[model samples]
Target: MAVHGTVAAGFEGVCEEFASFLEREEHDPGAQLVVYRGGERVVDLWSAGVTAESLLAVFSSTKGAMALVAALLVQDGVLDLDRTVASYWPEFAGRGKDGITLREVLAHRAGLVGIDRGFTREELADDRRIAELLADQRPFWQPGQFFGYHGYVIGALVGEVIVRATGRTLQEWYEERIRAPYGLDLWLGLPESEEPRFLSTLPMLTTPEQQAELDAAPYSRFSLGGIAFNEHAPDAVELEEFVNARPVRAKGQASCGGIGSARGLAGMYAAAAFGLDGRAPLLEPNTAAEFARIHSAGTDLVSDSVKQFGLGFNTIAGSFASVAAGSFGHSGAAGSLAFADPRQGFAYAYTRRRYAYPGGAAPENAGLLWSVARALR
Candidate 1:
């Protein structure tokens, strides 16, 4: 599991930390780590089975990109966060959901987590289909009262508003404004030309004890967590299968389904927060502050776990010791995490082909991030 790629001068410690983690893994994780300091790529490294250009499914890390697009629209006065969702898309008014504001939806407080009848794989591949199914559905909890993680459909939920208001899909806006402009490798709607670099996500390899823990865990497909992940469906899509499918990759469902390399992910954040290639930053300081500030905190109603969210993005500082207080990003089910730390003047991304045990934001990120912080000092 030899590490590949190079680090900028004086960032040798970050490389060491990456290689050290690879040495300890029982199986090669096929991981990539990329970091940027104010638009400069400081560290770029990958492990066995993946190259710096290799694209992998970034799961919910896709949310970070989704949020950024929303932020840009907001900054440009194209979308108003305080506006009621129904105002933009009248169909959303069905079933007592007329009052949920765009702001509440961004904060995961709109309470439209999922439908009782889960989506088919085809519907899950397309954001519009997912949005249409849940538009008239009742909220699991009173909107704006309790926050739940809209694990699988937050993108579609918000994306529908984008479609209605802007007359363009969120993915389209992302491509025209962000991805294409920056020449980033990350793709919400991956093109056929990029298929060769894409690698299907590998399933998590769990130990017997871990398997036992998973089996023993209290879980039911009917529960909120289960529904959020669409486990209630008769032909539920597995976490890995969601992005691996060609349709999902091509359509780019938004909640997940993003295909990218670590370089692409990290570079996106850099371009968003620090202006890459001599261009201006995508977000103004005020817009970044608004999106990065924690809007929801405490135990998540859906997952029943402590989580904090800042308008569709994870408020990273509270969850990870090394991240700055205003840092905002998202992690994926496959152990990928990407974010921009405005205070630190850095953006970071880590992706793995093999899903890590216990899912959501691989545990290795803590040590690796700390090492990056140390290198900064």
Candidate 2:
């Protein structure tokens, strides 16, 4: 398979590694990888079925963008991290959740994963509807006592807080403050004009053995993990189908409704951490440091896996040995990963059109990221 796009002279290894990964794949992953080294894009590469400009649905990676918005508000004194979420959104106080702080929510410890009945596809597309549905529901755990990957509803939970505090939605704030200013293609809400650029994410192609493993795994619609992903919903949509719908893209649910390319993902982090195109970085050093600090580290009750969360982002260093300890970003269900390593002075993003087996930051990222890191070093 032929790879397209250019890499900076020193980063030829990243391009080679990307090509090798694609060559090994049994199918076209339709992947794109972009790296920014301190405000300068050092690598831009894409595999077959996608161009650098093609926008793809990046699942939980959307959470990173949401977290960035929250960090901005916290930095601007518009939202206080320590303040109880109920203090801003009174309805959120229902069901013994009055003490959960904004900080805890960002750390995935607020325990408002999803409603017991689950959400319809339409409800999942609308953040306001989701917030209303969950406001009075019971939390799965004691507030702030443990952390879990909230998966689907975290954005609505956090977005509700944003609405009550700033009188605006997370998508609005993101467009005005982050996406528009930086001209980043990463979008909280994708407009119709941009719709033509989006390519629907393809499903994972698993082997018979892989299918058997998936089938054998314990899963129930009512389980914590199931509910977190909204599998409990009567009209639940598959992860790929959820974002493929036009309504979901238009509303940009904030959790997994994000649509963008590797450039857009890399640009957003670069703008936040290193400034893009000569503008000053959107986040101050202290702000970036605070968000990147590991807030939750342990076995996640929902996913039942050991994970490290820095605010809303996965601590990239923990998952990828090549990155620095302070690195932070979120990975998508479709094998996309994007983050900034402030300590190492680079921002990196990788997106794949086809879902990778066993999901969440495709295994290829381990080698690809290592190549990028090695080049930088």
> Which numbered prediction scores highest in TM-score against the true structure?
1
Deviation in angstroms for 183 in model 1? Answer: 0.6
CA lDDT, candidate 2, residue 146:
94
- Candidate 2 yields a Cα-based lDDT of 0.90
Clashes of 2: 0
lDDT of 2 at 249: 88
- Predicted candidate 2 versus true structure: per-residue lDDT over 229-332, tens digit per residue: 88988888888778989898899889999999999999999998888778888889898888889999999999899999988778888888888987778999
Best by lDDT: 1
Per-model CA lDDT versus the true structure: 0.92, 0.90
- List pairs with backbone clashes in candidate 2: none
Error of 1 at 4 (Å): 0.7
Each candidate's TM vs. the true structure?
0.99, 0.98
Report the lDDT tens digits of candidate 1 across residue range 185-286. 899999999999999998899999999998898789999989988899999978877788999999987999899989989999999899999999998999
